[model samples]
Target: MTVYDNCHLGHARAMMAFDILARYLRFQNYKVNFIRNITDIDDKIIERANENKETIDALTGRTIASMQEDFAMLGLELPTHEPRATDHIEGMIKMIGTLIDKGHAYHSAGGDVFFAVRTFPEYGKLSNKNIDDLNPGSRIAEDESKKDPLDFVLWKSAKPNEPSWDSPWGPGRPGWHIECSVMSLENLGKHFDIHGGGPDLLFPHHENEIAQSECASDHKFANYWMHSGLLKINGEKMSKSLGNFAMLKDLFVSYHPEVIRYYLISSHYKSSLNFDSDSLDQARSALTRLYQAASLVPLQESDLHEDSVKGFIDSMNDDLNTPEALSILFGLAKSINSTQDAQDQSMYASTMKELGKVLGLLNDSSEAFLQYGADLTDEEISQKIEERNQARNNKDFLKADQIRDELVSQGILLDDSSDGTSWKKS
Candidate 1:
C-alpha cells in the first residue's frame, strides 16, 4: 500500500494516516511493500516555477526537501521506493509502445498520442462508470482526430520552449495519467496490494491508470484502492484562490508539528478534517496532559505486555481506527495520572510509551515541548520570581499566589522541594 502526496505536499496528515495503516499492518505480521511516487514533472510544477521565475528542477528539489523534513517531523517511515516521474521516462516510453502495439493506443498527426477507451473491455470497472455517460473536459477538446471523445491523452505534443522528450511519435512529454501507470508497473510489477491518493484523483487519474495498465499487462492493477478526503478550513474548502490554504511552514512557526499531526489524526482518514487555530490549541493541551503523565513515569526498556495492551492493538488493527486508538491512549494516561503507587506508575508509563509508538505522537518530554518557543527571557522570569518572593516575605500570600498562578498559566509549573524552589514547563 502507498499514499500519494501530490496535493498534500507540506501537510503531514496524509503521511500520518498511512503511517498508522502501515504500523497496523506490520503488527498483523504482513510484509507490505509500499511505493509512493513523486510527480516531479507536472503542469502545476512548471506553471508555479514560471510564475516565480524559477526552473522546474529548482522548484521540485526545494519542495521535495521540505517534504522530507515534514515527513521526519511526523515520524513516517520512508516508502520502499520514491520513484520520480521524470526519472522513469524510458519505462513510460516502453509502456506506451506496448499499448500502441496492443492496439489500445494511437498517435495523432500533431504528434499527440491518445488511449482508445473503446478498445479496453474493463475500462470503467474502477470508477463504475459507463462509457456512454463519460463527458469531455477542457483537456479533451473537440478534436476530429480522436476516434472517441472519451479517449484521454497518453502523450502530449510538446510546444516550442516547453519540456520535451523523444518518443516514437515525436518530441513530447508523458501525460499526467500515464506517469503513475508506468512508474508503478516499473517498480511494483503489474499487480500490487494497494494504490492510494486523494479523493479528487479517483475520476480521471486513477481511472485512466486502471484502463492503461490492465489493457497493457492483461492483469489486475491493484488489489485495493484507498483515498484520503480533502482538507477544509473552518467550513470552507482550503484553496489558493480563497487565500485560506495554510502552508505547513507557516503553521509550524507558532504550533508544534506534533500538535498539527495530532489534530490531523484525530478524525478518521476518510472524513473531512476541518482546520482551525482552536482545534490545534485543543490538541496542544491534550498532548500536554499526555506528556505530563508520561513525565511522571520512569522510562523502561522491557517489552510491552500484550495482554495488558490488547485494546490498543485491537483498535489499530481494525482498519486503522486511530480515533479509537487515541481513546485507549488517553485512558492509559488517565490511569497513570491517578496512580499513587510507584511500581504501577512505572508499568503504566512503559505501556503508554509502547502504545504511543504506534500512534506516532507523545514521543517527547513535557519540558522540552513546553519550552518550544524562546520568547520568555531568563532575566524576566527571575524578576517575576523576585517579586513573588517579596510578596511572600511580606506575608501577602494572595499576591504571591496570584503571581505563581500567572506563571503556571504560561505553562511554567512551580515546585518547592527541600533543596529550593524549582520551575518546569507544565
Candidate 2:
C-alpha cells in the first residue's frame, strides 16, 4: 500500500477498502501485519518540487504530512510499518546489485541498470500478457541503452540538478518499481502474505516487482495479490487535463469524511466506484438510517447479531465483497428500526456498531453523526424548535409549519415522535 501524489479519493478508496479487510481480520483474532510503504522520491515528486520552487525535502515533507492528515480524516487504521522509499535506498541498492549478480539485470553503457525482462521467462505472469502485446508507450523508448524493449530500468542515471543516490551503477536513484520491491522486502521480508495496490499497479508495476523480487530471493514474493478497482469522478477518469481531478480535502467542504468512506466501500473492492454527488447523497441517507436506529438503543455493549455477523464475514471472505457485507448492515439497521423490544434494539445496535467498526464506520454517537457539520448548531436548532413549539401552542400552526419547512430547506429532516421532535441532516 504505497501511496503517492496528493492522496485523493482514489487513494482513499484503496486505503479504506484495505483497512476494512485489515480491521476485519484483526477482529477475527488474526494478527495482520499490514505494511504500507510511502514513495517519497519519484519523477513526479521531483517535477512538482521544481515547479513549486521548493527543495525536494521541503516538498516531500509537506506532502507526506498532508497525506497523513488526509488518512486520519478518513479514519484509516495506520499500517504496522510505513517505510519510505528514500529511507530504504541502501536496501534498494543492495537488491539491484543482487539482480545484476544473478544476471537478471544489466548495467548499460549509459550508466543505467535495467532488469532484463527477457531473462525472466515469467515476465508477464502476473499481468498474464505477452510483452509483444504491450503498448510501446508502456515501456521506455527503444534506445540502444536498454538490452531489450521490454527491459525496465532498475537504476535511473541522474540528470543535472535531479536527485540521485550513490549506487554501484553510478550516482543514480532507484526506479519506481524497484523501490516497492526493496521496501516490501525490507519491512515484510522476502516472502510476505499479501501485496496490494490500485488496479493500475497490476500491470507493469506489480509485474516488475514480482520479476525483480522473485529473481533476487528465489522464492515467492507474496502468497496473495490484491488490487482495488479504479475510482472515477462522474463516470469520467479523474485527470487534471479533464478538469475532473478531485482532492479529498476539497470534498470535505461538502461531505463528511465518514460519508466519503461509506460511499467508497459501498461497492466491492474489485469493482469500479463512480464518485458523484448522487452516490454520496445515497450513502449519506443510508448512514443516517443506521445512525438513527443506533440512537434508539440504550448505550450499552451487547453481543453481536449472530446471523448478520455471519453474513458479513461470508461476504468479506468472498474476495472482499463489501457491497454484500454492507447489505448485512442495512438489514440489521432495518431490524433495529422495526423492533420494539428495548433489548432487541440494544442487541441490533451493538451488532451494527461493532460490525461497522470493522468497516471504519458507525463509531460516532448517533446524535453526533446526525448533527455533524450541520449549518445550524445544537443550541441554534434547539432554540428554533422551542420557538416553533411556542408558535404551535399559540395556535400559530402556519408559523410552526413554516419554521419546519425552513429547517427542511436547510437540509434538516425533523421527525415528530410521541416524546418530542428529533432532527437529522438530510
Global lDDT of each model? 0.77, 0.85
lDDT of 2 by residue, 187-207 (tens): 888899988988888988899
Return the TM-score for each candidate structure.
0.88, 0.93
What is candidate 2's local distance difference test score? 0.85
Once superposed on the true structure, which residue ranges of model 1 sit more than 4 Å away at CA? 1-11, 138-144, 302-308, 377-426
| Cα distance off (Å), candidate 1, residue 247 | 0.9
Per-residue alpha-carbon lDDT of candidate 1 for residues 357-418, written as tens digits (9 for 90 to 100): 77777677776776554345656666778888899899999999999998888767777667
After superposition, the stretches of candidate 2 with alpha carbons farther than 4 Å from their true spots are: 1-5, 389-402, 416-421
* True lDDT of residue 22, candidate 2: 89
Judging by TM-score against the true structure, name the best candidate.
Answer: 2
Clashing pairs in 1: none
